[model samples]
Target: MTDVAPARPGPAPRVVLVPGFWLGAWAWDDVAPHLAAAGLDPVALTLPGLEPDHPDRGSVTLEDQVCAIEDALTGGADGVATVLVAHSGAAAAATVALDRHVDEVAHVVWVDTAPASDGFVMNPDVEGPEYPLAVQWDEEMAQGSMRGLTDEQLAAFRQRAVPQPAASLRDRVALTSPRRLDVPSTIVCTAFPAAEYRSYAEQGVPFLAGLLEYRALELVDLPTGHWPMWSEPERLAAVIADRVPRGAR
Candidate 1:
């Protein structure tokens, strides 16, 4: 009998879900079950300062958040890469972490957000130790739409919201690796269409600038609100499941 060749290793069948400011892993509850059903393990993360109850505020820096993400990206079984899913404000820290661990990530799915350019500060208005969610929500709405969220969903969001560390927002991004752009990336445009994001990228928007350099980047239009995990979770889950590396699936 001819000897059989061993199967090549694939990425870990895991997806790390990181939510934006003022939210925790609980924000992904609606979408996690569906991902699990699709044969992907979902590890939802609550960054250092956003944990339930008042954790240390004002003290958690952007580096702290980056470390948290790096921790999640490591220790996969069989030394396989992982898929990272970052939503809203979490994308800033995720971008820096991705830059450092580009080889460890199979793909990055930025939900209604984009990788931040180096030196980008997440929130310029944070003056106190803890930045409240209300103020940030208003500013976010002014910048984009929260179109599909219902009153009940909005109330629940408010109830579950926590104060984000001022330092995390104030700290600037420090990306040194140009190789991170080689990793595959997908931007799921929710509040706005892919066309709009492309337009911004063409016009040289600071936040969208990194998208231009990504060697493998895709933009998917999901058509909901910025917080699609809450408003269109099933569809969002489906979109993410489709991007899981085929071997992992």
Candidate 2:
């Protein structure tokens, strides 16, 4: 008798996509559907605290974002060990949430974002003491008081980039120690810099190398600006599908 491979059990691992600040879950519009085609359940999630409609948009904080994500990944959700895909600013909150609830997150992809570096690591990257240019930098961020898209991209971005609570950026990520978590992570780094803001902006991947677990997940480099989802959705989705949990795809 010929030996055959045994079938895998249980539900397919899910890919939960989180957009950067100023972006709604809709940012993952093109990617999630592609994940679905590849046999992974991809869904873009908007943390509860992110409400564009509210006048007091500043009410939200990083902790609140993490808590909301915690509930979204709450036990008895769709699948086990779900992959958390976060872009830009969301990487900070996603890192905290994963550390807080390790079991819930199987892997996290920091796509064009920071790795939530510990104390000293975060200090140097500070925006400095100027509004828009430096201080009040959080508000200057796209999620904050920054400008939005053109006439064509306006509608879509408006629907997606909702009001992220101000507290999220104000509150820092809590770190017990300067140690890297064992949780698998993938950094889908972009080839082109979104804005020539700072030196490290050009070397984002290299900067995060000190924090991310390069050995754990595949590090993909896409030739595009910061928002690959908007510029090159198909390619971005392909990268995500590959890094998603093995059984997931």
Candidate 3:
């Protein structure tokens, strides 16, 4: 009888989605299913204080957010690597998780934001049990991505928007593991082209300075307002699905 070879294992197919300020896992509702259809398992998360009914947002710090992401990344099925998708201000929390669990993370997709540098606070001046929506809709509509949304959709968004915790925004980033920089990353740029973003980095903008630490970085431009997930979810999902590690796909 001929000897038989053992079957090879399939790719690690997992992704964790993290949302930005004043939003929850629901923010990814339109995108997650598409990722799932592409053969990747997507886990969308709501951070500690971003919940609409959370009572003690003042005590929720950046560390709390970091811990939540770390747990989600590592707590997946054994031997399966995970990719992290963090939007806006949540990129800081995702970066900390990448730093803490470098080996377990296959890649990171930052939506419209990059990781902040050490000592950088997300929103320092917002003193809040919860920070309220402060943007002027008319100005935002003129220059923002919500131009495609209907009046009813805009009203629904405003109703569902929750207050972000002050502590999470105020805390400075603390990255200990430099190896996190070695992990591959993609920045999905919305509201700006890749060239403009690169220019900002080259011009030494303080916020863009952290991009220097990334050893393997790719910029994917998806021009829309800052919140592409809301305005162009199908396109956003397609872009993200393309970046999922080939093995996982």
Candidate 4:
């Protein structure tokens, strides 16, 4: 006589990759295959106005971005959790979405960004529908690190970058549930160190303030530029895969 275990149900946890301002799902091309190779399903999303030459760019709001993520979480098979990987500015919308659909998400990975709390507006400085990529790039260079990118990579980034929707930046983040804090989360520190991230959270930095109250949070230091997918795809993929539960992987 032999005893066998019953088969597990549903699909493995899906990895949903959301890019930040001025970018599209194409931005994740370098990282997706690596995640797939690690036995994980990776889905990169291009939010409403991020598509090149998108006709309705003028009207896309932050709420729309949140909805896009909600749709992704719901579109999957039942009982299959999702690993929502949000990068840079996309963290705002991802924060709200995670709060709304906590049970549907297995884990959240904030790469080079932090979870914004309720009423957090991305950028109030911009007054129009589109924030030019070049202008944004200049600001990023002045205020942030671009350490790991090569000249060719920078060229490709400039060539493909699209205008970010100012409305998305202007609309405030709306959070209703506190349960999201209980969802397992990881902060992948690339442009900065984990210690700095902790300090920022402790100091009540608006974008990272809620982290202080998270029930299951882990900080990991990758030590690269902000856009690790472009600079260190394989390494970033490995870090993300390591977060997934072993059964799902």
Candidate 5:
């Protein structure tokens, strides 16, 4: 008789999730269900400015976004262990918040998102080929894309995709890496190449702290569109589950 091998164990660990640019906390709505089943609790929230109907959306800045997440982490009396997940532009904001509040964060997941970047500094050419929704003025309230939106979704985006603060993206980013964050980080870009307006090609290694930070990064590539949360939530959740271990609290 042949000897049988032992079975592999499942992963564990809860995470705090953040969304990319032009996306509110709603971005992860589809993915949360899968995470819930896998025994990973996802702590999700919208950044301060991306609300559907905020009166003052343009005034939102990087500091403001970071503050909102920091408040959520520190607000509760019982501290929870969270692996921070950031998509797209939110990566910059998350970078700042995590550096300041690492005591509360366990790991960081970058999903087709920019790495820890400088949100405060920018080149003088500044105004790029792209603008918020292709519109220069913040008051217009448009930037970033909604990958799997329907007609109704597009309308909703048109209504809610508020103008990002000019300073947030234009300003130089301020993020520092503490040694404690060395082991828990993963960068998940989609399996396919980025489309004209859908890819995160703008993000490069320069964005990460190759020198100062001591984290080992795992890159998980999956076959899906830009919006994996909507197009392939189950698979995305599986990929995420692989990176985070359970009972990390």
Candidate 6:
């Protein structure tokens, strides 16, 4: 009698893509296909309040966002590695998720933003029932950020952009787990150079300071704008595909 062999599992790791403020899963539409081509599974999330016609923006807090990402990580198939990729304002929620699920998450990729420290609020002063998207492109760009976006792309972004929940920005991130600092992390520098970001971390900049705690920190330069998914989707996907592992860690 011939012995039957068990079927081997597919890929070990999957990439979880979390878009920043005013963006939904649609933001990753361009990037996901490329990741798939590179043999990676990309799960792009819209987040809670950012969804079109979502009930109440004010009710969505940072913890709610964190929980959403956490559910994604834990709900995946057993023994599958997971990489959390967060863009812009979503970094805080990603950080909290990494803190809570340190054992399960393999890597954290921060695009144009860094993890926020405990008690940190992204924009506490920007009072919001919901923060409206800025209409002016020039005024919307932050210093070196938001480069490489065309006029048409800008117009499209403005038209589709949703208002960010106030609580998500104003509520503090509460992280008690110190083990989160042990996870490997990569910071994709889009608006700023890697050297400049490292300098900021060295200087004890509040937001960037938490990066110093990471056991394995990699600074990758994407050299685009704040929204690389819109500006350079292929390049963004390539960078992410290269950094994330294919097998369980």
Task: Give per-residue CA lDDT, model 6, range 19-111, as digits (tens).
Answer: 998999999998998777666678999888898899898888888889899999888887777889999889889888888899888788899
Clashes of 6: 0
For residues 67-167, write the lDDT of model 1, one tens digit per residue. Answer: 99999988577555478999988989999999998888999999988988888887687798988876336746734566688878888888889988999
Off by over 4 Å in 1: 1-12, 135-144
Each candidate's TM vs. the true structure?
A: 0.90, 0.71, 0.90, 0.91, 0.71, 0.91
Best by TM-score: 4
Ranking, TM-score, top scorer first:
4, 6, 3, 1, 5, 2
Q: Model 3 off-target regions past 4 Å? A: 1-12, 145-147
Q: Per-residue alpha-carbon lDDT of model 5 for 58-151, expressed as tens digits?
A: 5666788888878765654344456677776677777777778767766677787545544434332435322354423242221223344355
Report clashes for each candidate as comma-separated counts. 0, 10, 0, 0, 18, 0
> Candidate 4 residues 1-249, lDDT tens each?
111223246565689999998999999999998777666778899999888979978899888889999999878888666799999999999998999998899889999998888788877788877987763356566345676788798888888999998998888888999999989999999888999999988887887876787889999998888899998898888888877765664
Provide the global lDDT of candidate 5 against the true structure: 0.61
Where is model 6 more than 4 Å wrong at Cα?
Answer: 1-12, 139-143, 246-249
Alpha-carbon local distance difference test for all models: 0.85, 0.60, 0.79, 0.84, 0.61, 0.83
lDDT of 3 by residue, 24-136 (tens): 89889888877766667889999998888888888888899999998898888777768889998898788888888999888888898886666677777877566766545
Task: List candidate 4 stretches off by more than 4 Å.
Answer: 1-10, 135-144
Worst 10 residues of 5 by lDDT: 135-144
Q: How many clashes show up in model 4?
A: 0
